[model samples]
Target chain A: MKAFEFLDEIGTVNTHTMVLDKGLGYAYVEDALKITGEYFDLLKYGWGTSILYDTEIIKAKNELYHSYDIKTYTGGTLFELANKQNKLGEYFEELDNLGFDAVEVSDGSTVIDPDIRENAIKQAKENGFYTLSEIGKKNPEKDHAYTTEQRIELINKDISNGSDMVIIEGRESGKNIGIYDEKGNVKTDEMTQIHENTPNEKVLWEAPQKNQQVELILKLGNNVNLGNINSNEIISLETLRRGLRGDTLGKIQK
Target chain B: MKAFEFLDEIGTVNTHTMVLDKGLGYAYVEDALKITGEYFDLLKYGWGTSILYDTEIIKAKNELYHSYDIKTYTGGTLFELANKQNKLGEYFEELDNLGFDAVEVSDGSTVIDPDIRENAIKQAKENGFYTLSEIGKKNPEKDHAYTTEQRIELINKDISNGSDMVIIEGRESGKNIGIYDEKGNVKTDEMTQIHENTPNEKVLWEAPQKNQQVELILKLGNNVNLGNINSNEIISLETLRRGLRGDTLGKIQK
Candidate 1:
């Protein structure tokens, strides 16, 4: 039992918490996962880091996460790089070799025509892997170039193209990207519009900040899937989702 | 040469950046150290995390850190607990068994009388560990009870009692503790007073937040030693120290 169990509330909220593994060593991954495996479900080897790791270590970490019933995948930037380089074929081959249960395709760092992005999603489906494709850009100026209408259209296209889930790009920093502002605060108008436009069940909001997570939980309900979660914030995020934290306490529903 | 050399005025900054390694496995430590070992001098097994790992894994991580010439130590909270539980001797034996060349003694989470706290420092020195002791309580109410004079006395007492370094507690959150306020901003008056009263070279201020780090660096110069740095922030912190980042760019002497 927790030390302050008297302050707890009753609930069983199945939260799909995704941790950002930005180039962790297999040993670090093993040790951290041992303590937190039961608390988190998905792990994204953050943005192009998998490309930098040895194939043996990548393979080993995949096996380790899988043993704990955790699904592992590459960051969307890796997928975007693969597509931008016309190396999607090679990417899938490597993903299979790496034992990844899933792969993330994104246009976060590149400009992919909507039709081209859709085709990439369909191809990922044909490869027999769970597909999570993201919609946004990395640079703040170019990211601001995207309208809510454009983002909604892209989300629909990816879903129709067979994406299992669509991730909103928050990047690692989470600020000045997509729905977040320069101060890392959510632009609620666009956020609500995107939520209304998409099937919320298939959407994963990349909330890397506590306030963002709290706001998303308050607005979207307890079971909302959140991504770009730091490795340390796994349990904390779960607590927020379950109203175990001060920010969301007594406000979130069971 | 750094990519943005023209943006900086390089000097003998001699910065000490310490990163936390809370229960990281051997291979993971090796892999992470490959990317970040250049940026840190000390590695802390965060708050009682040393007790969670196998003795063998702890030894291996210590050896791995040593290969990079990074000294390894446990968090101050662990030392406090050991002292509180009357297992201080056992803790030192375990530290030796784990091959840690350094250790921290802090009363962050628990209370130790000034005499006992100083004795702990002397005992750690006699045991051949490079000791760093921390001031300030973990609980906010208890911490606020400490006057600046008391803090100064504690700093001098620790150094005189054989501590290699003295740390002002910033806790992992870096908020409402030590010199930081509720918004994680540094209380400038208290901070400057501490520096004025204590030997700055013998002190490592726990500035976990970016703004707190910027404040301390701006106040104490770029060569100022900081602790409790997250593993990911090593490169970013280095950039700040060298005037490479937008925040500290052109402001730092180095």
Candidate 2:
């Protein structure tokens, strides 16, 4: 029952869009999902925000997302916090009890031994949860230390370690970080190199900016996996992927 | 009944927070209002977006906002569109019929003679609608043509011509336009000069960025009228006003 059905040019591309849910009210999410849910693939309760909200609300939100067939996971920061506390087992248990069907394993905010990172990924899979592992430091200085080759190695390692998908670190602000420059423009050479060498289909780029989303979609086709999209921009991003927006209009191939 | 009332140091300062609504679903508005309606002073259907949705939806949204005692109006772009089409009277009647009790009289996207601008403000008042006149151009090049004195003159004239409040243009992005620089930093000297000359209470600054919001709150007190705030940032802005967030914590006087 979508409006302008005749103009639905995006077609079935099997694109993955992971929306960032940073502490939104359940009713708001419910209503928003009604408008843009079918386009959504995954939902991340943004970094450490899951711990802030009432447990009942988180459970309700997880169930709501599940009803829409969107996989729900706590942000990587919570996992890092739990690892810091040496309560990884309890963290996994907490996620299950809260009805989250997915977990993101990331050492962005804190350090985790390579074995622990791999084990956590495997544990999440064993625990009947879809695992998304991220590879990048939250600190820009540390993030910059990894060469394109190093990033590729980490992405591959995570996938081999049983991650269903590995995410590239773009953070919420897609500026001067990872494959983006100071003005949030993509570093095309590095992007090309990474795409060529990595398991491209399993890699989700955290493109929080509109330009980044447009660039990625145009370069890699509309089926490109885009993550960290703001809740408000969900419908807008779908339009971009479909060439309905002016930015991507007449550019996306049906 | 608010959470952590003991931590609320803001002490109920009189403030006006105008949120930009770009075609939100009714259920989303209902849910959002439960969390933030009390904090909202006005809801603007951003930049001719009212024309895109069905009239029934617009009327429903206006009613929903009015239920929370929040005034609802279409964006200035709609006014400019009406002026361009020479449908001012029809536009005013349509707004009333559509259940919008307020109208924004602005020349952001198009030029209006001083007499016409003033007449529009007065006409809106005569029609029994709350009138808010905006005093900046939407295009940066055109906006830059107005000097501080010229801008101040417009503000004074708009108020004298019967504008309930005059909004300074910050156009969604709050960057390199008006009082903001290319980096979205506030131009302190220009801002100081404008504030000193204007009828401050009747002026609502459209500060969409976090830094701008923080800087304005710190300099002009938490009670300063702020417009063009994104819908999602309503509660966050309220927190900043009340000194609840880290940026404004210990900054605002109790």
Candidate 3:
């Protein structure tokens, strides 16, 4: 039973939240899971940080997330690095050995041929992994080049190509990427276009900022899938989802 | 033995880092300490977050921090809240019972008479607490009203009134407050004036941004005291201090 349980009875719906675990220690993950394990649906080991720690630690964290029935995967950068090295086969094998149940396929930091990108998604799904494909470049200039129509088309194509979910690239900063403006505010017109075209359940917005989360939730309803959330903000985000926080309080519709 | 020890063989010095603990779990604190515990000198329960958690959990966290020889205190907002209720004496007693060995005396969110502010610092010290008094308003507009000269005078006075450390408030956002501009960049002239007039060891700057941390480390020679650091960035800040991160790698002064 949560504190303020009476106030949070409304707006409790099936929502997907993917938290970024950027090189947190094993004990810390365990501690956080005790409180907020049920709130988050996916756990992402952020951008090449997994390679910095011992393989044993990574494996342990994966197993821990799995215990809570949460899907876990390495960041897309690691996958991109493996693809660049022509070691996708080895990467899939290592991911399985490391206990990862999901894989993020992205070309944010690198370019991949469309055929190869679709193939990566198929291979990840074939290997019994939850495949998440991302749209948008990490560089602001590169990301801004993609129109909303282009983003929506890619999101739909990835969903058709066997990605369990398509993640809009907000990066860790959540600034000037995908559907967000330079100040980290949501480009509502762009967002609505993507939402109207894509399957709502299959598209996860990588909203790392509070305003982004609130805006996404209010615009798309409480069940809007949000990703790239900082690990510390898990409980806080859950409150926002349930309209317990001031931002979404009395504003969330069932 | 830290990983990448070879790359971090330079710029080691005695420094004070106060991390903001905005309600972390027990195992999480233990896990963080296992990795970067020795790096931080103080742990502040951010704002009124402490009052929101159960007293037992707060006490346990305080004890946990103490075990690592890191002094723990509630944020200045809590101190001000207590002061508003005329419960300063009770606040000190409760702090002792909760295992906190430090207290922050400040009027960031409320007004405090000059004599009362001095008395609060003296009372905290008399209670054998490591007293920290802040020198900025929580509101950006009000904070900007303080001239560098006024800030310097207050800081010097706080130290004389028995504050173990005088903090220059940068808030959690670290923008448009104290020495930071709207873009969160350091106001070099204002920073220099404060640095020149105050006793460096007795002053702690609240710099929650990476750029602010890097700038302070480079300008103040790695030993400059920093506060309001995000708990997740403890290791990252340690890396910056030791010239391990790209931002400060070749720039840190001995």
For model 3, state the Cα shift of residue A11 in Å. 12
Give me the candidate number with maximum DockQ. 3
Worst lDDT 10-window in candidate 3 chain A = A1-10
DockQ, all candidates in order: 0.06, 0.08, 0.09
Interface RMS deviation of candidate 2 = 7.3
lDDT of 1 by residue, A79-169 (tens): 8777878899999888999999898888777877878777778877899888888888888899898899999998987888899889998
* Count of clashing residue pairs in every prediction: 1, 0, 0
lDDT for each candidate structure: 0.80, 0.85, 0.86
- Residue A105 lDDT in model 3? 99
Please give the range of 10 consecutive residues that has the lowest summed lDDT in model 1 chain A.
A1-10
What lDDT score goes with residue B31 in model 3?
Answer: 72
List, residue by residue over B14-102, the lDDT tens digit for candidate 3: 97999987657887787779877889989997765555455666777788888889999877766775676677887898888778899
What overall lDDT, based on C-alpha atoms, would model 2 receive against the true structure?
A: 0.85
Question: What ranking emerges by DockQ with the best candidate at the front?
Answer: 3, 2, 1
